[model samples]
Target: MDDEPEVVEAELVEDDRLPAIAEDRSPAVLLAEEDPDAWLPPEAEEDVQAGIPKDTSRAYKGDMDRFAEWCETVGRRVMPAAPQTVTAYMSYLKRTPREKTGRPYGPNSMDRIIASIRSSHRAAGFEPPDTMGARKVVAGYREQLALAKDPAAQPRKATPADRRVLHQALARLDRTTLVGKRDAALMLLGHALASRGSELAPLDWPGSFTELPEGGFRVRVYRKKRKKWQNVEVLPDPELEMCTVTAVRDLVEALAREGHTSGPLFMRIDQWGYMGVEMTRNGEPIGDPTGRISVNGASDVVSRSIARTGLPGDWRSHSLRRGFVKSARDAGVDIVDIGRHGGWDDQSKALIGYVDEEDSSGERNPLAQIGKAAMKKRGDGGE
Candidate 1:
């Protein structure tokens, strides 16, 4: 027999250009991490901590920590940092590629990192560094990306999970499995509510979600964009198989059988079908056993559901929200109504952009219509 060709697998090598965490941290971060009593009394500390949302607070801390580590490597002061040092940091972040993605930080991400650095300085009772230079550099970076025709220059939009995708995903799901039931509920609720993964992750059964006297349910959610709570109604769909209420009902009943009455509406499940529990890895707790699934987990549900649906374009958690908007717009739903249901300000440019883009395609396109009219005239020998 002929010798088979040697098969070799390609492995991704870690990008050494990516910065590493340093042992030393900024003095302000050290003070913040050491002890709350050292800075403020217990009562005052509690009030101070409550001022910022938990997610924002965690993000700020993480960003600052990374900045502090970078400062240590460069032998620069993080707190009371000079504008030049800040500019240097921004430049470094812009040029350095991430180990996993092999891409430099995008402009929006860099902006948030800069904001975090400023917040850390303000919290430490120091004047924030002047970032005019850094801002200009970021603007120049955007221009460079535009010149290079880099897709990163534009915002990445998720593929909308239209009816076809939803139908395929729903049909393929094994409703008998616990994971399948949960995935069904997650996908339905995500699409019906037009909710972000972050908003959907913290739902508490019978607390945030409640049954209505009329069919379907009412879900009260805190809109992060609006910084206020909004009540949204979900009516039963005409199609029983695609109804959000039915999906939720089935998932809740299945969960009750497992002795989980209330907590996070969506939760993690293991390969063996056991619900996620308090667990540790490397002596650090993985996640709160009493808490619901993480934002990423909610996204995973959407992605997993649609993976085998043979759809085109990139899909993620945001796909459900975008899908709702696109589907509603296609049905000739008013832009204002769509924005209201989606928890977006009626005047929001982001929301309007979606509507405007959808309006420009197919028969709605002015150029396309003109082309068709000209063709008809030519065919009639009138041109």
Candidate 2:
């Protein structure tokens, strides 16, 4: 948001500081710790207003909200936070219920919240908070996470799929109908592009996926992290059953019949598992349009695919994107190329197992290092 959240100009945190321990005065801040455009000069105070990217603002709020909630529970102030309080907050987070997974947060998820808290504090005009103690807290959490990372300890998010596994998941669906065709197309293109479920339903026929003279599709991608649009090419597959080209072509035609030609490529299918441009009751369009499939709905497609095929109980929405990295890395593709294809500026952020400890340098792709063979194998399978 352009405007900063209002805060009391006077710091209300002196009373909130955790009591200092006399025995070990060695100081260490636990977690590393925004503004409006108008009164502040535009360029100099850019960080004050547009400091955080718009796409991530929701995440920023979520992190701070979580932190704020914890602080409230312990009767501490959120702003001008104390080193001890931050440490305590991390501990609280660790203690919270964490689904089938034993730990509340992964190292990466914890780091994201930590960064968000720091950013929020800075945006509020606080000093750059010392993070001396955060290293220990995060390290501790990481160690705990490592111990519990086994398949039994953590269900492990829909395990990344290899070509055979991916196609096998695809094989569970019935491709003759609209829902089948759309799901098939979604998974095929989604894996080929290494896209998140959130990115799939927003794709436009004419805008995002454009027809190319030579055959296949040119998919324009709006990256969530980068907040920029770029095109990725999908060539015609030699195999017809699972070809990205044919799958999408059939979907586009099917959607066109349903009056969804110009907008979102993936639309909500109704009770009979039919795609309709609007919510229809007794064949009549009703209320607001519910045609655009939600991220959750798209995710269910993957989950259902896994369930029907009996692939694995832990498999969920992230399988395809994660699979992209695992498949590419297994193929020994270059890291930089992978980053470019995956739209990740930070190659180190790719799915963890895709690279072992020796290769975990922050310089590889999170997904695409270039290999359509896996996706092609998927596209050729008849669901």
Candidate 3:
């Protein structure tokens, strides 16, 4: 009887290259170069190369390099780190403190490192674990997180005093100035749209806004969350339409007033008054590097403005969204209608959550049914 041949696998694989697998029964897999049969499209290859951010790519590469070094120290090939070895490494990372920071790796940072390691393994086409088992582990982790107490969870509503303070902060700006006009417009649009910071960070001037019929304006929002363009009709509000319209008009006029019609709507203006549209050399607008600005920027802006205005703690960006919901409820608009306006697809429960029971039927008031009872008693007495 012939002996089964052992499989030999390579340690490292490059992009678009496949590792050679030995045909023999000894389960060792070999790493090989590009297989003509499994070719990826040029565009797909390019996308893969560019899928991760530059910084993220660097960090991933560094982690892999470190892992390779560790493998070398243990006199083992980098391709196959046994499950036990990987678990040990994970424990080491948890126990190890940063030499510079003197702190253990944060949970989020550790998660990212593990993710990078997994990606590296996938890139090399290594069969590490059963997919179903991995999924169960991930699901359990998420469940634990959901049950964990998070002190930083956002509040459901903002106090009225917070709004007053935020308004005062915004009031300090002189709308007559170009920067002031732009900031004012940004605040109103952000508040009204409840837009994430990233959504407004790259606002295009002439491309995004247009005049509409009936003295209204149409604003095109590039919703990053939906990855699609959304059209919003800004109908004139009888109460504040004039001022809002003026603010928008002022911003538009400022953009075209200086013969600059094709750049970022909100250009960063330094103290020297040098004005140009904000964009990267690739013609993409400068986006917030730390995603915090997009979601939390509005809150920060509102908070800072409030602090500057010296107002109390009732106003916030979230207050804007909450206020809109509250106002709609007070105006007798159906919850479904409000949800649609708020970009919620399945909002049945959410809408119900917003409706204050007391505000809805007035049945909670003891005196409300008392009048009918008194009339019934009088009729019975007469009989």
Candidate 4:
């Protein structure tokens, strides 16, 4: 995602030089009581009223808000933005300390913030201000920054866990509970499919997860990266206790017993074990899954499953996907096959060396290999 827009891992403190707004002034009161400014024409107003994609809209609004705050700090006009104003904002983003870290925004993040600003300006019917050649400023800074860094002292990436760490996490799940069973299946399928949290979060049962021959199953997912629904197969584990199929089977039957056969595959469960229902407050069939989990919720569930396992503090929903890649590479699976799971582009150097052009076998799907490897390791008595 290029990390899904400048995620602001660093902190930029508010400039103390700026005047402080009164704490008692409510934002709604200020906006409502303020004098009338320029207003949008009907069609433009209608376009704004029409629904927008939630993700991009949030991102754009966030970028604009940050830009406004920065403008206020520097005494610049935000709406009729000048090129010099854009340049100053970009400079601040690059030089300002991020969050608690003294480090400034990274090149990838800086580019996204600039893109967000550009999009907002264009949407407002103005050409992007050409200060520092507008977009070219970011390009110039990236090149200059690249040259400034000592090539050998590259930032260290988070330590990625291997298959054993994953197996240990999976073992910690208490399979006696229905929620536990669902968690087990979720871990396996997420790894097996090499899926993203966005893909895993909104899954609809009886549709997204389909049955296959011989107790195996094929997962159909709509991945944002792929721009369409795609299917990846998960082979049943002969070791009944750990098989993804068995876990899902149990979870499905349990949910169906509560009169749920459709809607989100991963529904939120209350502490008392209450799940989503098709009925409303009046207690009638509503014909849908009553509750849905969020992307962050999906990550939280995975974290809770492994909380006691002591693998690492940073284990996340994406941990399963990374574990799949590491496990596959350790098993000598080709790079080409790895990219095939979610149609990930292989041209990036990140997928190199471990990839084999001619290493085709019965195990074309490396995700399945994760189960096989984890099972083998567990069978070897905590190897």
Relative to the true structure, how large is the alpha-carbon lDDT of every model? 0.75, 0.63, 0.53, 0.63
- Candidates ranked by lDDT, best first? 1, 2, 4, 3
Clashing residue pairs in all predictions, respectively, total 0, 10, 15, 5
TM-score of each: 0.78, 0.69, 0.57, 0.67
Model 4 weakest lDDT span, ten residues long? 9-18
Runs in model 4 deviating more than 4 A are 1-53, 94-108, 130-162, 238-241, 277-289, 346-383
lDDT tens readout by residue for model 1, 1-383: 00011111111111121122234554344556666544545576466656665555655666677887888899997667899988998899899998979999877667767777776665554567899999877888888898999987766677788656788899999998889999988888888888877778778787887788987899998776567898999999888879999999899899989988877788888778888765679998887667467777777777778987777666777778888887787887888898999899867987876664767889879999999999999999985
Off by over 4 Å in 2: 1-56, 96-109, 145-158, 274-290, 328-338, 345-353, 356-383
lDDT of 4 by residue, 1-383 (tens): 21122232111111221122345543223433563443345675556534333455565566677887888788786644788888778777766887867777665656656666666554443355665554566666677777888331232232233456657777887777767777777777777777766788778888776677766788887766536677888888776665777777788888888788988777777676777533456766443355766666666776777777865655667666666776687787776788777447767454452233323344755666887999999999966
What's the CA error at residue 264 for candidate 1, in Å?
Answer: 3.6
Once model 4 is optimally superposed onto the true structure by TM-score, how far is the C-alpha of residue 125 displaced, in angstroms? 3.4
Q: What is the lDDT of candidate 3?
A: 0.53
lDDT of 2: 0.63
lDDT per residue as tens, model 3, 46-84: 666555443455556666676666556765545445555
lDDT of 1: 0.75
After TM-score superposition, the amount by which residue 28's alpha carbon in candidate 1 deviates from its true location, in angstroms, is 8.7
